[model samples]
Target: MATRADRRETNPDLGVLAGQLLFAVQRELFGSLAELGFDDLHPRHGAVLAYLEVDGVRATDLSRMSGQHKQVIGTMIDELETLGYVERLPDPADRRAKLVCPTERGRAEMVAADKIMAAMQERHARRLGRDTYAAFKTAFMDVVENQRARDLSRRP
Candidate 1:
C-alpha cells in the first residue's frame, strides 16, 4: 500500500500542494476565530484584511495589492462593513476616493487571527520539528520574494 508520504512525493503539481496547505491553514485559523466570536467573517475577507494597513488604505490600493478586482473588493468591503469589521471613510488625500479602515472590531479580529496563526505555527513546528519548520518558512519566503520579483519584471 502506498503511504501518504509516498503519494505526496509523486504528486507533480506543487501549486496544488501549496494551495492545499494554504487552505488547511486558513481553515484552522477561521475555526479558531469562530471560537473567539468572529464567526461572521468569511475566508474571502482575508484577501482584503491581509493587505489592510494599520491607519487606513484606499480601496483601489487594496484591490491592487490583493490582486482582486475593484468590484469584487467593493463587495467584500460592503459585507465586512455590514459586519462591523471595516468602514469606508472619505480619503483626505483624495477627496474623490474613500479609504477602507478597520473598525475596533476588525482590529480585535486581526489580533485574534494573529494569535490563532501563531498557535497553528507552533503546532506545525512541533509536528515538523523546530529546525525543519524554520527552514520551511525561510524557503517559502524566498519563493514568495522570487515570484514577486518575477511579477514586477513582467509589468509594463
Candidate 2:
C-alpha cells in the first residue's frame, strides 16, 4: 500500500516547490526590510505601504488592495500612523473619507525593501546563471498573469 507520503516522496509536487520558493523569498524580503528598524511591519502592512506609495487611497480601497477587511486596514493604518510611516489626509472628493499616504519614513522603508529585493535578485543570479534566473522570472510572471486571469474569470 503506497501511502500519500510515499507518493510525494517518489514524485514531489512542483507546485509545492514553487510555493515554498515564493514563501522563502517573501520571508527573506520581509526580514531584510524589518532589520531596517521599521517595527511591527508584517507582510500585510508592507503590502499596504507599497500600495500607498503608488496612490493615496481610502481605507476601503486599501482593504481591497490588501485583501483584508476595512476595519483591519483601518487598524493597520492607525498603527502605521503612530509609527510615522503613514498619515491620513482628508479626501477632497469625499470630505467624509480619509486618504492614506506614506510618510517620508515609509518611503525610506520602501527604498530599503527595494535594496533588499535587488540584493536577493543578484544573489539568485549569482547562484543560478543570470540567463537561467531571467528565464525563470519570465516564466514565473507568465504563470502569475495566467493565474490572475483565471481567478478573475472564476469570480462570480
Candidate 3:
C-alpha cells in the first residue's frame, strides 16, 4: 500500500526536522522572555501585541494577520482587556466594528519585552560570533520570505 506521505511533493523528513528546529528556537526565545517576567504571554498574544504595536487594528484585521480564528482573537482580546494591555475603541470609520489599540501599560510592557528579546539576540550573536550570526540571520530571513511566497502562491 502507498503511504499517505507519498502524495505530497515535499520531503517529510526535512519538513519534520525544520519544524523541530523552529520549535527549539522558539522555546529558547520564549524562555528568555519568561526570565523577564513575561511568562504569562502566549504566542498568540505576542502576535496581537506586535500587530497593535505596528498600528491600531480591527479584530478582523488581527485575525487575518495572525492567521487566528476571529473567535479565538476575541478571546485574546478579552484577556488583553482584563490585563489592562489593550482596550476597545469605537471605530471612527465603522460603527459596528471596534478597533483594538494598545494601552499605555501595553506599550510599556512591549518596551520591556523588546529589551529582553534584544538582549537574548545579542547573547546568541555573541555565541555564534557577530559575522556568523549576521549571516545566519540573513539566511533565516530568506527562509521566512520563501515560505511566505509559497503560502501566497497557494492561496486561492
TM-score of each candidate structure, all chains considered together: 0.81, 0.74, 0.69
> Which of 2 and 3 is ahead in lDDT?
2
lDDT of 3 by residue, 1-156 (tens): 557567343545646767776677567656766676667666667657756753468999888777777898899999989878899988889888788988887777678767766887898899999999999989987987788778878989
Clashes of 1: 0
lDDT of 2 by residue, 46-153 (tens): 547756753478888887666677888888898889988889988889899888877888778878887888999999999999999999999988997787678668
Candidate 2, TM-score vs. the true structure?
0.74
Off by over 4 Å in 3: 1-39, 91-97
**lDDT sort, best first:** 1, 2, 3
Q: Candidate 2: how large is its RMSD?
A: 3.1
Which tens-of-lDDT digit does each residue in 3-120 have in candidate 1?
7678778863667688888899889888888889999977899888888766789988888788788999999999999999999888898888888998999889888887887888
Clashing residue pairs in all predictions, respectively, total 0, 0, 0
lDDT of each: 0.87, 0.79, 0.77
Return the candidate ranking by TM-score, descending.
1, 2, 3
* Total clashes in model 2, counting residue pairs 3 or more apart in sequence or in different chains: 0
Where does model 1 exceed 4 Å of error?
1-9, 151-156
Which model, 1 or 3, shows the larger TM-score? 1
